[model samples]
Target: MKALVIGGGIAGLLAARVLTETCDDVVVLERDKLSDVPEPRAGVPQGRHVHGLLVRGGEIMEGLFPGLYDELVQAGAHLMDAGEMRILNPLGWVASTRTGLPLLVVSRPLLETHLRRRLTAKIVDDVHVTGLSFRGSTVDGVLTRNGRVDADLVVDASGRSSKLPSWLAEAGITVPEPDVVDSRTGYATRLYTAPPDFPVVIAESLSAPDTPRGGIVMRIEGDRLMVTAQGAGGDHPSREPEGFQEFLDSLRGPIAEMLTDAEPLTPVYLFARTASRRLAFEQTPGWPGGLVAVGDAVCVFNPVYGQGMTVAAMGALLFRRHQDFSAKGCRDFQRKVAKIAQGAWALSSNADQSWASEHHAPGPLKRAFGWYMKKWQVALTHDQDMFARFVRVVHLVDSPAALMNPVVFRRLAKYSRQDPRRGRRRAGSNPR
Candidate 1:
């Protein structure tokens, strides 16, 4: 069997890798001529920013491509304890202790480059896919600018700017309208030479309802630190140096102080218009067979959560588990993919919604849940066990439902009676 994967990003590479297990020949079509080394490409705008592979994402990728973790680590990717990273949440600074969660901090380009090199499939760069070729109600191949590439399976692993919807429409398939939640968030990033013994610093500003601004400073490959300043609603980070510095200074943690003496390697790279979008491909009636979508082509999360790569990895893992690749199984597979993305989607969209002005007001139950979560956040500052559970959910290793456990509720109830301001004071005092 032959398979064709659209786009040569991380998602496409992983999709092609899994397809190789069943198909004899797999071809990846990338519009851009990929760089031979770790560098930014026009296709991935977010590539210029920071990226991290969560523990679950790393495990899934390693399962698909063995030795991948070691290869990246040997290539200068930092494998640090996630708990050791200095993180300030809306509730407070997360407790700093070993949580056994391994975080792989690497540049986006480096990870994609490694995955591209490892995949056994043939990657034909600069081939712009235009549409799909259909046989009756089933997709038979992809139509590219060069020519039609006939395949038994066609996977669209294209990023957020995918042309799949138009291509599917051309093939007489009408997909349902996508669910979109735009936070109108923007951010600016710059690369700098890392100082010795620098811990990862992330000062999150989502805690304040009036102002949603935050920043992250983490060491990536090449011994360089990537600092990103984020702004919610219309408070976008500036592309100019002075304004960017001001944005960083406004964050609730030590991110601004940490970068005071750092030497910059790259100019501020601005990425505005970060939104959470999910295509309802599974809900489309008469969904064609021999076609599938994964990664950002299916759902895109706000990058601040650092869930994009992990969610894409999870989608690829789903493809690996599904036995059927035909149109008959496409719907089922897509539905399963949507299900897998739900947790990340909720986590990201909910947070983004808080920054949205036109957001729908939560009902009684949701309001109650919100109240409990606010208390839970305060409790996370004092409760190491609860913080660990929150980290697990954030990494997609566990469900958000775990937060609603009776033990957690009891603990939150106990902490809710105390002065929440005291918890904030403790979190602010930690100078790690």
Candidate 2:
């Protein structure tokens, strides 16, 4: 068997990596020439922006490419307990405690470059894949700038700018309009020089309605640090130095002061396209055989949630664990992958929903859930157990359902009743 993967990003590379189990030949076609050095590329517009590797994502990647974590650390990636970082959410500050969940802090470019170096499959760079080539109703290969490349399976891992919709339409496949929920948030990132021991990271999330501005101070490879400032609901961070600093200053906490001591090495890079979108390819009638999609090609979450890379890893794992390899099995694969996308979509869209309530009319159940989550975030500030649960959920190690345990429900019920005007009051005070 042979597999062809288009768009040699993390998802595509992972697909190629996993297909090696059943396929003798697997080829990944990437548009831009992938860099050997750890630097941003044009292929990933948000490469310069802040990116994350959730705990579950790190676990999946490590399983796919063993020793990758150690290799990354050797290459200067920061590996630390997730709880060591100081986090400020909409409710209040999240207390720092050891939760044993590890965080791999590295630039998107650096992480990609390291992961690329480990791929055993042949990667053909500078190859622009235009569309999928089908044999009858089954996808057989891909049409590229050079020519058609044959394969038994084709996986579309192209990200936010995927053109699979047009390709499917050409094949007479009718797909419904995808669900799109935009956060309307934008962020600006800048690089700075820092010592090896940069201490702990400081982050303040973009709170909704009342406060929509936030930022983070974290370290990466090359003995450098990254400071990212963000503003949601159209209050965006600027690309210029003065404006970037001003934007940071406007956020709550010491988000702006975190950058005061650091020496700037790069100008601010601003990105505003932070919408959460999902494409229901699996639900479409007469889905094509011998074709599958993983990662942003199928769903894109608000990057603020940091779910993209982890969800992509999960999709890759699904492709590997799947038993069937024939064209007929492709339909099942798409559906299964859709489930993984759904789990992540709920988290991303729900967070953005709060900021988009004016445009959205969520049912009573959803509104109640959203209300509970806000209180839950506040609970994270005071309650250690709740904080741990929240951390695990965010890291993809635990499902959101875990936060709705009977014990937590009782605690939240009690906390909600106490004086609403209590300054900085937190939920889950009594762990009973």
Candidate 3:
């Protein structure tokens, strides 16, 4: 069997790697010529910003590619202890305690480069995918600007700008209406040279009816600090240095002061295309066989949640587990991919809908979930065990149902009785 994988980013690379184990030939088609060194490229505009590997994502990647975790560490990726990092939850600053959940801090380009090198499949660069070649109701191959690349199976690992919908329509297939949740959030990132002892700090103010803003400062590989300031509801950070600093100053913490003396290594870079969108491909009737969509092509989470890479890795892991390339198996696999994306989708889209006008108003169930989540955040401020549980959920190691467990529900109920004013004061007390 032969498989043609599109896009050559993290998702495409992982898919190709998995296909090599099942198919006789696997070819990855990348539009851009990737760099030998770890550097930003035109393919991934968000590569310049801060990217992280959640605990579960790192574990899955390591499982798929042996020695990958250690390679990243040896290549200078910071292995962060969740307890060591300072985080400002919606209610207040979380007290630091070792949770043993390890996070890998590395640039997107660095991680992608490592994965690309580890893959044994053939990667053809500078080839743009135009459309799909279909035989009856099954995809026989992909059409490129250069020529047709025939294959037994075709996987779309293309990012958010994928044209698969239009291509599928041209092939006389009607897909389901996509679910979109726009956050209207933007990010401004700048690289700085930091002292060796600098600590990673993140301050997040949950989106409410009012505008939301946040900032993070973390040490990345090459002894550099990546500072990102985020804004939602048209309060985006600016591209100028002074404006970037002002944006940081406007966040609900001491992020601006923390960067006061850091030596700037790069000018502020702006990214504004943040919206959570999910394509319900599994719901499409008479969906073509031998075709699958993974990663951002199927669902794109708000980057703030840092779930994109992890979810992509999880999709590839799912593909590895299924190991069936038949038409019926492909459809079943797509359904499983949709299932795998549901948790991350809920986490990101619900948070985004708080301030985005373009998103549909939350119904009673969503509202109740949001209310409980805020209460859960408040409980996290006072409870270490709750914080650990929340971290696990965020990392995708545990299902969202874990948050609704009887024990958690009891604790949330107990914490809800505390004076709301006291929680507000506590949150306002620590600005750092």
Candidate No. with top lDDT? 3
- For model 3, residues 1-432, the per-residue Cα lDDT tens digits are 899999999889988888888889999999999788999989898989877678888888888889987898799787877655677765667655678988787788889999999999999999999999988888999999988989989999998889999999998888898998887889999999886567754555545655388877878778888998888877789999999988877766666766778899998999988888899888777788889999999999888888998899889877667877666777788899999999989888887787677657679999898888778767877787888888889899999999987899898898899864466434334433
Root-mean-square deviation of Cα positions for candidate 3 versus the true structure, in angstroms: 1.8
Spell out the clash pairs found in candidate 2. none
TM-score of each: 0.96, 0.95, 0.96
lDDT: worst 10-residue window of model 2 = 423-432
lDDT of each: 0.82, 0.81, 0.83
CA shift at 374, candidate 1, in angstroms?
Answer: 0.9
The order by descending TM-score is: 1, 3, 2
Off by over 4 Å in 1: 426-430
Give the poorly placed runs of model 2, Cα more than 4 Å off. 195-197, 325-328, 419-432
Flag clash pairs in model 3.
Answer: none
Error of 2 at 243 (Å): 0.6
Model 3, runs deviating above 4 Å: 359-361, 424-432
Give the candidates in order of lDDT, highest first: 3, 1, 2
